[model samples]
Target: MNNTLLPAVDTNLVPVYAEIFLLIAASAILLIDLYLKGSRRNVTYYLSLLAVVGCAVLTFGDFNSGATVYTFNGMYVSDPMSNLLKLFTYVAVALTLVYSRQYVTDRGMLSGNLGGEFYVLALFAMLGQMIMISGNSMLSVYLGLELMSLSLYALVALRRDHATSTEAAMKYFILGALASGFMLYGISMIYGATGSLNIPDIAASAASGAADPTILVFGLVFMVSGMAFKLGAAPFHMWAPDVYQGSPTAVTLLLGGAPKLAAFAIVMRLLVEALPSLAYDWQQMLLVLAVLSLAIGNLTAIAQTNLKRMLAYSTIAQMGFVLLGMMAGVVGDDTSNMPAAYSAAMYSSITYVLTTLGSFGIIMMLARAGFEAEQIADFKGLGRRSPWFALVMTVLMFSLAGVPPMMGFMAKWAVLQAVANTGAVWLAVVAVMFSLIGAFYYLRVVKTMWFDEAVDTSPIVTPTDMRVALSLNGVAVVVLGLIPGALLGACLQAIEMTLRS
Candidate 1:
């Protein structure tokens, strides 16, 4: 290999260091689980927690540092965006481990894999996301995306004997492969047009007026399509509901939680950094997808009787709101397009992930062996059984519906304002309409819990660890909503960093 093609040998390797810590912890957990038995298995949980904490520490330790360092030519970079993404990834995965232990163990999802596979897979997925956030080249992006997706393919099917879990995994695998293929093809097209795979070079080529518009636009479409699939937007969201419904509750929690942070990072890289020149075309494409996702996600969710499935569609709609923020950032008619739009979009993404994680945490609380805790009916009179859980779910549902005094409401408001600032009045109207449609389902869940008669069966609540984690998970949602300054501030900083860099 040519020496010139390699990345800088000495640079801020803190990001890589975080991955190493996680790898070592994961391997150690696997070995310990293999040799140990019974209650000792729980040690893997603490090890995973340690891994996340270590990663978080590294993230902050490397804060505010910016370098366009290249390892393997221009394949990777340690920049502001990557740093911000890793921080969020750490938080999300940590919360997943905290809330998921009881759910996974009780459901038998921890069998045959040293009881630490979920944590290991989640860490690897985070590693993949880290790679994508730092990716400066097409090769890096594909590697990161595959690393994340492969782990998820197995994760969704964690309960191998469960028919729905197997089906969900199969669907996700096939669809994910197709999306990756599209992205790869688009990368090739972009390279053909620009004669380079490095993102900065592609942007420079476009700036120099040497790039072909046709090929670039074609590549942009394919790239956006793949991202849309990742974001679970309309027309590309066919897999989300099934996957969410089929996977174990803990897996659903993981699926919805931290990955969105990585997805946003990927979007920022591909659309905001690499293809800003094609904003008009992609903006229009995103506009249509946003409207469709909002409309379909909300309207269909109202008719769904399954809680996980409902949340699955709700997630799709939330992505629409995110798209609105992104469109405003890139194509708004407003004078201050860069930071204002970016801040709004990013803040929305951050808050959405937090709220979604908390929402899934409620689902995990009710999950136990021989009981999926997925259907809406299962929540009937839940208030009588567990008032605290009901309250937490209420907060999650209302926030998702954009009710005021909650972070989700603020997130929606910020994006809607950005959209209106861009003079996209119709898009804003669609968002409002969909919000109401979504509220119906959310409200139904609350009503079923508080007003409906209690079912005779009591949910299994064996694990002491889960009960404690679930309690915190519920409390965290309200706490985050009521005091969201730090999180929002971090998101704003992330936007500034990425744009300025």
Candidate 2:
């Protein structure tokens, strides 16, 4: 069973205690939930929230202490970027739980005696993401990715009675497994070429012209394919719409948020950190991926009647923008612009997830028992009933559509700015065009909520905490859009400190 633990220095284990604490907390939540009365099940919920808070505090404190610290023989690490990303992940996951509580309860996922598996699995998933964000080696990255992927599969299928959910779970499991295999095969190829699974070693090998060029390129292609799939970028984004539509909204919220950060981390770790010498090849691949993703994702989303599917495609297009920013990193091999280019992509990813967290939170807010609120039509006349939430949704839509004075606009602009700085004006132009095209559906959602006649006319109900969170989230989106300097600077500094190769 390999119970013998690997020896780790104190510095390596410094930030690791947080992961251990979360593991213990998750197990505690599971055990504690088993004995609690159904009426007091909220205890587990609060405990989960507390655990997230605890982790956030720990990560935040760690961020101020140093810029980079490697551990576990360099398989794990802590740095400004990882710490900042972890802080965001904790907040995102906590907010997901808050928005999802009523939805799960109404569906009997937690109320009708569904076990605490949902909460427990969520913590485990967060743990996996944290690991991925901090992983410094191929083995650690793969392990973290699989851990997160497996938890999501279970979460999507948690409602065993929902046939659509079960179907989505099966499809997700199959596709996710294939993606993982592609990544693993690519890792093996890279290992064969460079004789190293460590990111820095791979970079050194590739840079020194020591690795087999053909094998490196081949591995790069497969790795990009796998990453594209994981990020739900085009040509590999087929599963998103179905999965989003089929899963419970709570699960959808979890799926849509936080994980993107982990995916971005892997991108930074593998392609950016491990193979910058192969930038020309991977950059071209990302170009194709970005163009296709924006085209197909935007063009297709306009026709979606389901809100979830609409957001699904929107995700693909947004990821295209991320690719554009990332591809700009190695222009002309000057390497001087790498930090801003990489940080632009990082900030873009964070902003997109932040906006998405709010958007999906509102979707969950509008939904109730017997009404999934899955359809665009379901939002008709929402403004009349719940103007506050309607306003929130409107802001979210405008942001997603990249309208000015909103976070989505700023996010898209940051990426485009980075791309344009690299003289990829044509790519920027295409991205902006698709963004315009994609606005139709987002604007459509906004219009339905504000202008259409009342269909349900039900009263709006939401928890006080969620209401507060929603307000703050919506405001943060707009405010950050207006003033993104601090956060963008933070991202740039993080990249400079940790990934300035």
Candidate 3:
């Protein structure tokens, strides 16, 4: 008898404790929520928040350990970058649930047949984001992307009775599917060229010039295009405005926030980590996309009368800065500046998500039962209505405009500095000019809030928790701007450690 003995597989679940915990917690929450009725739904909300906190606690230990760990047969990784991004993702999800509580309740999104599906879907979406952040292989990244995208699609269409919401969801779903198809085709091409689906193996193959160059370049192009669509960069950003304007404000917040961080993580994974040999090609593409995004996003935002649509365009412009940072990472194979440049990009994404959450939170706060305060005109004389929140809105607008003493300014400065360090002065100059143009629209909102006459003089009633959270959100932006060294240092360390590992 010739018996063949197979080698034992080594499996470590420690690297993915947070993800596993989140998955189990979210599933349990979904089942537990069904038994809760009426106002008891608050129990589900609190449970979801607890799940996020538990995930954060689970992740913090790994992050503090400052060690790179891989598990699942090299298909998953737990690194400084992933840990940091996951922490931020948890914070973003928690804040979204908090700020959205009253808004969703008023819109009937959390009641009746929906029955806490919003919370369940959000937790699931967050789980998907965590997976994406830690994904070490193409297959894992794609799986995580689809999971997150599917959850978001459902969230967008949560208001099944609303025609506009349904339309937006359809657009998002179709475009998202197409983007995923592009990415999958690209992954297949890459696998064909390199004979590997593992990111590090692909990197080695590409670096050694063992991969087929023609097929690899084509795959990179398609993948970058897919990444651009996910980031809402121009030319691929058609669905953003429609979806942002049509979905419930709370849903918009969910869409615009943590997903950006996850998207940034995958961009780093696929482009920088897996295909550094083709940096020049992808850098050129990012440069063009960045310029187009800035020109289109800033110029078009000026014409938008809908606040949500305007913010959507603003998101596009902000992503341009991030792309610029990514593009600046490698200049003619001099990779010394990569960590700094990519860290700047990371900082830009995190700050943008923070500012967006506050902006949307204010929008939701203004919305009452049966009325969506979506129009730009709705902000007229908001200063007279609620001076505190109006001040918060002004701070948020200033930050988005890249005004000094706000986090956005520091983020833009960091990106521009990184670009300049690479001798790309022209790119930095163009970014600044476009930013100047962008400031007009943001300031216009401030003017509307503080200068325009009061159309509705009703008091803005908000839950104490949201009020406190929004205030802290706004304050953090300013404080971070004034002293950005800590966050910037953390980002730099995270990127450096990630690349080293």
In terms of lDDT, the best-performing candidate is 3
lDDT of 3 by residue, 7-35 (tens): 55649999988989989998999889888
The sequence of per-residue lDDT tens digits that candidate 1 reaches over residues 1-501 is 789987556454544776677678767776776775556667777887887898888766666565434555666766666777788778788878878887777776566646677877888887788887778787788789999999999899877777988999999999999998899899899999999988888888876779999999999889988988888999999999998888887888777877777787788788778877777788888888889999999999988988899999999999999888888875533336656666777777777787788778777777666766788888888898888778878887888888877778888887888888777788888789888878888889889989999874575464576566556755665676788777667777767766666
Candidate 3 residue 306 Cα shift, in angstroms, is 0.5
Runs in model 1 lying further than 4 Å from the true structure: 1-12, 64-73, 332-335, 457-465
Which residue pairs does candidate 2 place in steric collision? Answer: none
TM-score of each: 0.93, 0.97, 0.99
Worst 10 residues of 2 by lDDT: 3-12
Ranking by TM-score: 3, 2, 1
Q: After superposition, how far is residue 176 of candidate 1 from its true place, in Å?
A: 0.8
lDDT of 2: 0.89
Quick one: how many clashes does candidate 1 have?
Answer: 5
How many residue pairs clash in each candidate at the backbone level? 5, 0, 0
